[model samples]
Target: MPTLKQKPKQRPFCFSVKGHVKILRLVLTVTSMTFFIIAQAPEPYIVITGFEVTIIFFFIVLYTVRLDRLVNCVFWPLLDVINSMVAAVFMILISMLALIPETTTYIVIGGVFGLAASVFCIADGALIYRKLLFNPSGPYQKTAVHDRF
Candidate 1:
């Protein structure tokens, strides 16, 4: 009698490096935002507002980037590069501010999250660059068009 073979178990959620980084950024952003809001540090409303905006943007981009068809758009890679660069810079600055010696515990926690987010953003940017620009066969490469006109 032939025995039936068992199939490999499937993971409920599997993600690539880019996807993982994106998810990391999303979680860190939310954590930092919540901490900042709750900490109620005086002044510097811009930082709070920036976090709010970033949280919203990441939520949307996270969903869009997961769709392969959407990611194939000519502007998608460029947008990802720009977004990650900006986010990294912004997080670095915010983290520094959050790390002030006299800051509260919540601020310090937020700072740590911000730093993590910055690292993830930088990694995401580098990966996007590698995937879309560094490789010869990347999406941004121009192909010769032979027109019969």
Candidate 2:
């Protein structure tokens, strides 16, 4: 048993240093957009968004290297891909609507951003947790779903 006074060992976050950089990039991308940035539809913004998206895709495609045959096959990458997609969707919507004259558009952008961002953040945390906390060998194991059963 671990002592209450002892600190838990720091777990490696699921991301490589490159992965950490991508995570940081996403954080910056989400926070960097302002009403003004969204209003202009600046070329730089589009470029940055595109770059972040590409990074997200690369992470999903490459995520399997760290994870083995157990739970990593589908679930981990699936969760991450969904998380990135949801974030991108809101960011896109918010950017498109921020310049519109309608107040409802502003409300919609804010509301969706709030909701989607929450889920994205949770998924991000879970990815890190899974990288650090999950075990491949255990008393409870991953069982394949049989099509016939």
Candidate 3:
């Protein structure tokens, strides 16, 4: 019989069938626990679900990006998707309100506000994505590359 000091061995980073499942379960349990804790927070702001931090982060990022170079890259295209979604939402709500004559003024107000926000969102997302993904082409290139985007 094997001595009490002897134990079965396992390869590093190579989980057995049972071990792999256990790791997955552990990861999922931790993730769900974190999500529930965040969900329980009071006075949640930023109407967009699950992206509140993203909005604040982008706002800060846009304050720093150089707008000229960004237009040449992929930021503008992806922003189009975001803007279209915003516009479509505004249009649907406005159309529904148009059926009620009293809401015509509110519809106009909402449309204008929506249009402005859509533009801001596009510009902000593009600028932030570019800033986080690229570095200034100067002495800081190598060092910045090592840091987070």
Candidate number with greatest lDDT: 1
Show model 2 residue runs off by greater than 4 Å: 1-40, 64-118, 134-149
Assess each prediction's global lDDT (C-alpha) against the native.
0.70, 0.49, 0.37
Tens digit per residue, CA lDDT, model 2, 1-149: 87577787644544355356446645545444332245444455455445545655555445535452445447654555465656556555544444354444434443344344445545564454455445823345666789547
Q: Give Cα distance to truth, residue 7, candidate 1, Å.
A: 21
Range of the 10 consecutive residues with the lowest summed lDDT in candidate 2:
106-115
Model 3 Cα lDDT, one tens digit per residue, 1-149: 87677676744322433224223323332332233234442122112212422433342244235342465655542453464345335434433333344334433343343334444444444433443444523334344655876
Candidate 1 lDDT by residue in tens digits, 59-94: 446545455345555566667778788878878887
How many angstroms is residue 135 displaced in model 1 relative to the true structure, after the best TM-score fit?
Answer: 2.2
For all predicted structures, in order, the TM-scores are: 0.66, 0.31, 0.28
lDDT of 1 at 53: 53
Clashing pairs in 2: none
RMSD of each: 7.7, 14.0, 18.8
Query: Which model, 1 or 2, shows the larger lDDT?
Result: 1
| True-structure lDDT of candidate 3 | 0.37
Candidate 2: TM-score?
Answer: 0.31
**What does the lDDT come to for candidate 1?**
0.70
Show where candidate 1 strays beyond 4 Å: 1-14, 42-74, 134-149
The per-prediction tally of clashing pairs is 0, 0, 0
